[model samples]
Target: MASPKRPIRIAGCSGAATDRRDAMRALAANCPNDPIDVIIGDWMSEANMTSRAASKTDNVGEAYEPTFLEALEPALPHIAKHGIKIAVNAGASDTELLHSVVTKMVASKGLKLKVAWISGDEVLPAVREAQKANASTFENIRTGEVLNSWKFEPIYAQAYLGGLGIASAFLRGADIVVCGRVSDASPVIGAAYWWHNWQRSNLDELANAFVAGHLIECSNYVCGGNFTGFKALETKGWENIGYPIAEISSSGGVVITKNKNSGGEVSVQTCSSQLLYEIQGPWYFNSDVTAILDELWFEQLSTDRVALRGVKSDLPPPTTKIGITAKGGYQAEMHWFLCGLDIDAKARMMETQIRLLLRPHAHRFTKLAFTKNGSAPDDPTNQNAATVDFRVFAQAPKEEDLMPQRFLRPCIDPIMQGYPGATPHLDWRQALPKPVYEYYVTLLPQADVQHKVHLASGETFAIPPPPQTKTYPAQQPCQAVTRGPADGGKWGRTVTGPLGWIVHARSGDKGSNCNVGFWVRHREEWDWLRTLLSVEKVQELLADEYAGKKIDRFELPNLHAVHFLLHDHLDRGVSCSSTYDFLGKNVAEFLRARHVQLPVRFLDRGRL
Candidate 1:
């Protein structure tokens, strides 16, 4: 029998394009004592993809993320000295350009690093061709709306690639692998696959690495960033929050930890928070393998170390997510403050006046909204505290329609006739029209993507689609588990307060949809939580945002969590969303702040 291979440690240095730039250097500096074999960085997201597409359309900047270069320059020496492999999907739309630049940087530094890049993620030509042949191929994944029904023309499209291309680059002796539009966890999956010489048949091991990759893909997220129990890190301080490292054994066991003596934490709760982030349902799908998250478990091994286990898997999905970007329109906003008494009445009067003024050219506007944020205190301490903000938001197909004269004039016309203490914030830039892009997310067949890897040895090879694939139902079949009751069972004594008193939550966006995952620290609480929080309950608690909107709910018993997906919740995502919580990061907090009946037994345990 073959000897068991040793475990490999992979560190995540970045979560997004805008994450802290010094994380790479920080992780590299600690590698002398605490060695890591590979460093993976995830730098793409729906929001940044829209921005990069627009930048490319207007020839204002490179389509790729420049921050990766900024972060890599400082850590190049340490990375070369330690001989650590690096993989990142920061290439965005221009992998070749980024590869060229990085190669030049390596040569300038006199380092012997061999850099390679993977491409074929850009599928604009294919998407356009499909649109001409059969538009149904571009059906929106969430809404089921066909692409022909969309108002704007898609200028750019990129399919989510798997990690096999990265693995191919590694096998070809490349020290650094740069990719474009690979799945967020692709870097980690590719690293693990290369380290263990995993084959396509190693479904469970790949799934283990997939989940581990998801957990640490966001860098400090598994190390206490975006955690609900942030107060727990008070002594350690949040300023220098540590990045996460995934230690994956040859047997498919995984342990999550951070740098020695670093700030923040790596507990089970922190791992659970990252696990539930931005997920759609119990089955976490990827191009290479589908992870069964319902049975996954996390255990605290020691301080700053948590073990993740029980993750199961099946064959890869036949299709992968693809995002197409188009110019939605131009948008502008105006803000007015309503102070002291009669806040609602003042807001109503201003809305009436603005609506009357805008009624003339309403047909030209695609979207118009009058929103009020906060309420004035009955008896306040200061003027600032007594003020509530009222906003007038407008979107139009043409920039001229959202210009200061067209959009802002109507808002300003009502000011003199407004209620007492109604004051305009008076920021001209806020009312000036700015271009916005709409991101349409759908699935593209894996076979349609021409996945290819360009090696440092001047050879290019195509990566075929996964040989084994499965087609799952649109909705995951319900599990056979049973719960207590919808009302959370009869606890004799109960108290009314915020749901957050005993619950910890994390929320994020998936295109225009928002997913909020809520979990408890104890098993007893999970019983009550699963029974109490229902689809109807969520609609009631978030009536303003979720009322009349479609919501999908699922339970992850192993993680002691319940998740909710709010469809069309963010007004078509960040670039065009008008809501204050545009990214949906605050949806969990919003639900937590809602008052609910809580059992005294759970409350007595103290707030999370």
Candidate 2:
């Protein structure tokens, strides 16, 4: 009764929070011809989860992301017409609310779709009990502070669930699945598992599908979006780019492509760049399986078509990570511009002035930070080019101290008497302080948690638990390789330029830590890169914030890439950070722009 000849095709519609609603509509419209079987969307992030958890206190159904409904409203007709199954982790912290809203919408549209809600990921009660028993064991991964030892009690906690629960829902004939806090790649893994009836121990097939899942997890990212080599796709259709789709066969062979008439190109370079996002080391862990990153390889089958292979899998770790959020008080920021010459002197003077002015009320705040962003380049062409954004950020214990009158008046009043060429930016919102929710990421034993699938028919199915309990040792460096001296005889003259002239990189945040993965286009340059970009070298590239900081480096030889994780660089993650690039998304670009010496051979391989 099944079509054994055809491979299963799944489309990734949206990557993160509120990703281009029009793009989702476009993917839905084009899916009929491509015959996409399953559609998945990812809408939850660390910032979103914290916001959603806080929203539940005000209203019942307000916790779920609104964009889920907005994206599906236009696609419902096409979905129903094509018999497409939908799965998404757009539920945020509230799956029941999302399910109710989506069910009502589907019913009102007269569409006969079975919507299933997958839950059991929430572990607040267990966390509280554990906190009471021995609090120190639930140490925050970022700061190594115990949960019970925190400044404020945690209000919400959710463990990251895996694909098995989602796959079980599909096996129960559910047309739509709304989930809370599943792994980012779970939807794709779930759809493929259900399509082929994969066994839990089918590690080979599952590993192949897992690689496919990760490739398209971020949707358009694999389709030349956010690619380091954007210039390569410049002439190609890039505007209004198509989302990524995986054509996975029954045997676990994967070929990544996009919709026929859509924009974007899916080349080896684009696929490899997406692979480096947010990864720390070679051993990539998931709730379902452990993917060996170094073993994976990519092949260009055709233009806009890449086949991912060589990925090997082992049994998953015995535990899954949990994210807990607590009130972190309030924070406010004020920005001033530093123009013309003497920029460093002006910035230092501004910091001294603000600190001295707030000295009388120093006890009112927990943290105060002064940041100088951008600099006056040599021989500037315009006033904007010579201006640097100087910011003063403060985090306070109470709302009164963080108020506009208290926080802003001190900084704004001294601006006129402050350093030469200094004036506050005319942004009113900078004066007002906003509440901060601190996040704690810790691991929970998989055995202590339960996972299940809930159906519209009021039936629930349970997934089998982990087979063994094993504590994975804290991640240590293993993959970085030692390289002998580069033979200077074959190399020609050295050229000086930005490091990105010969390297491509992608960076992202993982809790308080940030990772930047750097790669070279040519294989001949790997030896030189490995020797030049050591942990010490990377720390130097990051400048003072990373000076004397713990920086770990790993190598993915298969991709000709080197990955570095900067510990505690994000300043307690996104919600409570004073940095403008809170999530560390710009870290790679910042490093790429740093000047470095490169041999002519490697430089010639790229478009220098």
- Going through the candidates in the order shown, the clash numbers are 0, 0
Q: Model 1, 2-119: lDDT tens per residue?
A: 1238788999999999899987887787788999889999999887888887877777889889999999999999899988889999988788989999999999999999999999
Q: What is model 1's C-alpha RMSD?
A: 2.1
- lDDT by residue (tens digit), candidate 2, 1-608: 13635778888988988688765566667765677888988998898888787776446557888888989988888888878888999998889889999999999999998899988778888887776777438877666777667877688888888888888888888999999899888898888888888777877677777778778888889998888888866677777677888988778888999877777799878888888888777777778887778767789999788999778778888888899987788888889999988988888887888777788776799998888889889999999998999888899978888786677877887877788766898885966878888889998777767788999999988876667434556765643444574675556788888998888899888888888888886677877787778877887788876746577778877787888888888988887877888888899999999988878877666553
Question: What stretches of model 2 exceed 4 Å from their correct place?
Answer: 1-5, 57-61, 468-470, 479-485
Error of 1 at 95 (Å): 1.6
Model 1 clashing residue pairs (backbone): none
TM-score for each prediction? 0.97, 0.96
Q: Highest lDDT: which candidate? A: 1
Clashes of 1: 0
lDDT of 2: 0.82
Runs in model 1 with CA error above 4 Å? Answer: 1-4, 478-490
